[model samples]
Target: MRRRTMGMLAAAAVAGLTVAGAPAAGAVPSAAGDAVTASVWRNVALTGTYTIRDDEGIFAAGTYCNGNVASEGWVNEVRTPSVWWETTCGGEIRVEKHVSAETDAGGGVMIYVTLRFYEGTNDTNTDLDAEYNFNRYVPA
Candidate 1:
């Protein structure tokens, strides 16, 4: 009985580790979009859609290392809404937006995404490091 109990505990520990290591269900797929370097620092942005068949999209901006000031300017669906996001120069900020479906009836939808990097925590045109623009089309 002692040996059986030990084996059971070992199995439970392995199972717990496996469960903790597994990726969460419905995790979105990600792809590197653009990267910029300035003053020995690098910032990266990621772009992805919620799903291949959906008009929802995701964007992420982050700094490569710790200690610095960084900012991100994001525009979704073009002239619709714009947001300025900042990070503590180490982590990342992610945003999600849904594209209007009016164009879906016309066969596909057009999505405009703009990502800009700034040197400081606040986005200023003078402190802009790089800008990336994307025009994506999603079929109906």
Candidate 2:
């Protein structure tokens, strides 16, 4: 009889069925009240080799432009000093992101930019130049 009673008590203790009605071991608390803040806004400019593959376009060399970025998107603009022989020139902007254990520095980013300048006329009779495949990125 004593052995049976002790077995029942041990089983109850191991199953967390004590006199109280709280949770058992390894119980995790909910984190539904946490909040997050937005990152800061920044602007950067990059300058490097700008080239066009097939079609010849007149883009000036040795010029740089700044990019204004916000939570949504960014814009890039440039003015070539002088148009040279039909050449291609521009820079690209890329982003590299990482996370830190400390104050969430969010790691540094690397941006590459390419800018190109092309000339064309609105001649209706003849074949006028056309630009295509322009990719613009926007934040979510």
Candidate 3:
């Protein structure tokens, strides 16, 4: 009888631990609200000229431009340095970068941009029809 009671108590304790260690149903695991460490994609349309000072540094993947437009931009990586980049209509440009504790330390990253929609690929041939600017921020 004593042996049987001891075995039952041990089994119950093991079951209790298993249940306690298990996460609740439908609960999502998180990193205690830390900055996002994963890579994400972003899209923007260029019409005019503007500057984006992104402190979060989430837009490190680069930019994708579609439709008929031309763009010229420079990215200032706070952790490193600035890089000039541009793309014509129906083209893409890479602004590859990574964010970390070091990159997000001070003023973060910045991108100076100018976008124009022309009649064709040649900017000089046609006058600018539209101009716009965009700035986006991602939550930590």
Q: Top lDDT: which candidate number?
A: 1
**Candidate 2 deviant stretches above 4 angstroms:** 1-35, 38-40, 46-105, 122-140
State the C-alpha lDDT per candidate: 0.29, 0.24, 0.26
- Write the residue-wise lDDT of candidate 3 on 1-140 in tens digits: 32343234323322322100111112222467655433221221123222221111244223323332222222222222222223342221111112111112232323222233332234233444333332232221
Error of 1 at 54 (Å): 34
Q: Roughly what TM-score does model 2 have, to 2 decimal places?
A: 0.20
Question: What TM-score, computed on C-alpha atoms, does each candidate reach?
Answer: 0.31, 0.20, 0.24
**Candidate 2 lDDT:** 0.24
lDDT string, candidate 1, 62-137, tens digits: 2232222223222222234344233322222122222221122333434444444333332232454444444545
Candidate 2 vs candidate 3, TM-score winner:
3
Counted clashes in each candidate structure: 0, 13, 3
Candidate whose TM-score is highest: 1
Q: Model 3, 132: alpha-carbon shift in Å? A: 1.6
The 10-residue segment with the lowest total lDDT in model 1 = 17-26
Candidate 2 displacement at residue 5 in angstroms: 97
* Regions more than 4 Å wrong, model 1: 1-79, 84-104, 121-126
Give the Cα-based TM-score of candidate 3 against the true structure. Answer: 0.24
Q: Could you tell which candidate, 2 or 3, scores higher by lDDT?
A: 3
Whichever of 1 and 2 has more lDDT, that candidate is: 1
